[model samples]
Target: MEILNEQVPAPADVGNALIGIRGGSELDLDLRLEAVHEGILVSGTATAQIAGECGRCLDSIEYDYEADIQELFYYEESEEFEDDDDVDQYWVIGDLIDIDPVLRSAVVTALPFQPVCREDCLGLCNECGINLNEDPEHHHEILDPRWAALAQLSDNVAEDAATNKTSDKREEK
Candidate 1:
């Protein structure tokens, strides 16, 4: 049994499109390695600095995320995982275990698919590309295309009514 605590640089492409850990950033790893009957068991946590854009408002978002890491590396001669072809199996290579893939899997899976800067973010206006969070009341007076014909009809009716009223007043005078 052994404890491994180290700070290493984060790898590239450690998350989804919306959010990810920047390459070369600080990564803190705190884990315990144990030798079991089948293989070596690694369980720990990896903390990384996350950076990305908000999916809602396209704003810059930055935060820290800690991902849990746990996996078993089987010895070269071990045949325990041979029956399960669907599951991925890790191996101990030359008395060393490569935890990069394990750490990456842990961090990437925990990242949000759609990252947002805030829960109440109003997002951007589709019509004008303006951030609604800055001005929540901001809007454009855009009438629906389906109702445009009805609006035009109402304007024409008002014009006709005014014209008739003016003619009637002239006749009375």
Candidate 2:
């Protein structure tokens, strides 16, 4: 079955990586179902529009995504399975197969773990929380806490040396 431009609700956000699928996004599905001795094999491709913020700069981003769906929906009473509870298989229900789980898994795995707006995106500044991409020359003059005492001592020594030099020149005059 070929579904074109079918409006489907977007998937939920994926942790800090992916925000979520765009609302009112159209998903094009091209799927084929085949009945085997063990179960029905579902294979297809699903394409949709996904929108989220960039993981680095928090900029809004939208893009087209495609996922390949392929799974087996096993019959409930098929003799091919042993009486083990550890097997991972989908069971068919009364001539209807719920493809939501398969679709969700495929799309989520296909998405990038860390989505970026561009290849060379500069992340936010740690000190001021500013986007570094916009202002690459931004900086702060604050010294590291570990070296703060040493820095203060150096400044004081420099001042004392300058004062001594001026006193000696005055005495010479």
Candidate 3:
């Protein structure tokens, strides 16, 4: 992860090439540097597995993901972008370029929103307050009136159907 030595005058010729970076699941980085006309082009892929709570069931979930990132560090400094508020961020110092920031950016951007253990995970039961995944046979007590608007609607529909049937028979005769 140290590139201070590689970043020197051309005569230094230390390590301006590919380097492997291994860190926490924060990310595993593989980086390559190319001295282009503009500046050093850092290209690499970051991969890692993360553990998080499921959005629906609150269960622990683990996911492995990878993000490919490329960053351009222009050597020229101008008034177009200011570095006071962190707007100007470049890896070009004198000759040494760092890819940590680029890999971190890619890993952060690749993270998922609202992690989920499984797409079909059945969340806790609203009535019994139980994890549905853990106990499939769990049931909650039906205390309140579970049948009101729906029951009335069904009864009214049945009566109307009976009346329509009777009318139909009379008309047929």
Candidate 4:
């Protein structure tokens, strides 16, 4: 058994479209490595800086995320998983265990499916791309299409009535 505490650079593409850890950023790793009959067990936590845009408001979202990492890397000559073709296995190569894939898996899975800047983000207006958070009461007064024709007809009728009333008053004078 061994304890490993170190800071390593984050691997590329450790996130989804909405959020991710930038490559070369610092990742603080605090883990334990154990040797067993099958292979080596690596369990720890990786802390990384997450940055991306919010899905709802498109605001920049930045935070620190700690992902739990636990994976088993089998020896190259080990036959423990030979029969399990469907099982994804990690192997020790040249006595070295590459934890990039493992770390990526841990971090990516923890990323939010739809990241948000805040819990109650109002988001942008669908009609005119305005941030509703800034103006909660902002809205466009859109007349219903069905009522628009009726409104136009009413205006025409009112204009004709006014014209007839003026002509009648002139003839009376």
Candidate 5:
């Protein structure tokens, strides 16, 4: 079977994850089904337009994604494979096979756990919550509270030493 730019509802979000395909996206399907001794082998490729936020920068991202689908739908009444409990197969009802589960599995597995807009994305600034990619030079100087007293003492000591040195040089001159 061949499908051209068919609109299909995407699977639900995966546990509040950042990367996901937008719902009601266009999917192109090209599949071939073959009847085998054990079951029907389904092989196909599904292509769809995915939209999500970048995991690093949280910027909107859009891309075309393709997932390969390959699974077997076993006959429910077949007794030849009843003894084997380790076989993974989907149940076939009458002459129809549920393809939604297969499609969902394929698409989700193909997606990356952390999708980025680009490999070299600079991400956002933790202190200011600004996009570092847009302003690479943005920065903030935050001193550690534990060392604040030591930092002030060190500055005072440096100033005292400078003053002493100047006075001694003048006396020597």
Candidate 6:
């Protein structure tokens, strides 16, 4: 916002654009003013650090984001003014154009739809509700229900054999 002042010397109205972005957890921008044929074209970069949940691991995600912005301030009577296009327009008063809206828009445009913390992150298990990151042992087990039924049948057979042995011993005594 400090850099948007007209008091800042502007480049000659030509093909030049000025650009700068201030760093913060949330960013502030210095309007990049490029001298254009019709008006001063402001273009530059700003950044906002996005910190929140990771989509995959559900861990805290921190991202450094950079965005580019462009804003044009045309004089009311400037030749670029069109009657129909002028119906909905933004204007600058006292030789000053505010670029805050432009800055906000640029940052939003550069953001990812869903930010991930890491590329190869192993997410939490849906069934056991365990954090895969924390556990390196027994990562996963695959079970077949048919095999499980066979295992149960073997256990019952062993139990029956042991019971029959005890009954025979009692009868002999």
> Candidate 5 lDDT, tens digit per residue, 1-173?
42334456665552137766666666677778888887777887877777778899999888888788888888888765655667556877998898777877777777778889999999999998999999999999999999999999999999999999999999999
Maximum-TM-score candidate: 1
State every prediction's TM-score relative to the real structure.
0.92, 0.81, 0.55, 0.86, 0.79, 0.55
RMSD of each: 1.5, 2.9, 12.4, 2.4, 3.7, 9.5
* Residue-by-residue lDDT tens digits, candidate 3, 1-173: 22221221111211111111223334455566676666667766656555557666777666666668677676665333344765636758776666656655665555556555777788788876688988877886564567777878889999999999999999999
The TM-score between candidate 1 and the true structure equals 0.92
The worst-scoring run of ten residues by lDDT in candidate 1 lies at 79-88
lDDT of each: 0.91, 0.78, 0.59, 0.91, 0.78, 0.58
Sequence-dependent TM-score of model 2 = 0.81
Predicted structure 6: clash tally: 4
Q: Could you tell me the lDDT of residue 121 within candidate 4?
A: 93
The candidate, 2 or 3, that scores higher on lDDT is 2
Backbone clashes in model 3, listed as residue pairs: 7-96
Compose the digit string of candidate 6's lDDT tens values, residues 2-103: 344222221122111111222233354545666566667776665555555656667876655655666676765677755585353445566877665565
Which residue pairs of candidate 4 clash? none
Show where candidate 5 strays beyond 4 Å.
1-7, 14-16, 80-87, 158-173
Alpha carbon lDDT at 131, candidate 2 = 99
Cα deviation at 113, candidate 1, in Å, is 0.9
Candidate 2 residue runs with Cα over 4 Å from true position: 1-7, 11-17, 81-87
Model 6 steric clash pairs: 14-35, 16-34, 17-34, 18-32
Q: Clashing residue pairs, candidate 1?
A: none
Q: Which stretches of candidate 1 lie over 4 Å from their true place?
A: none
True-structure RMSD for candidate 4: 2.4
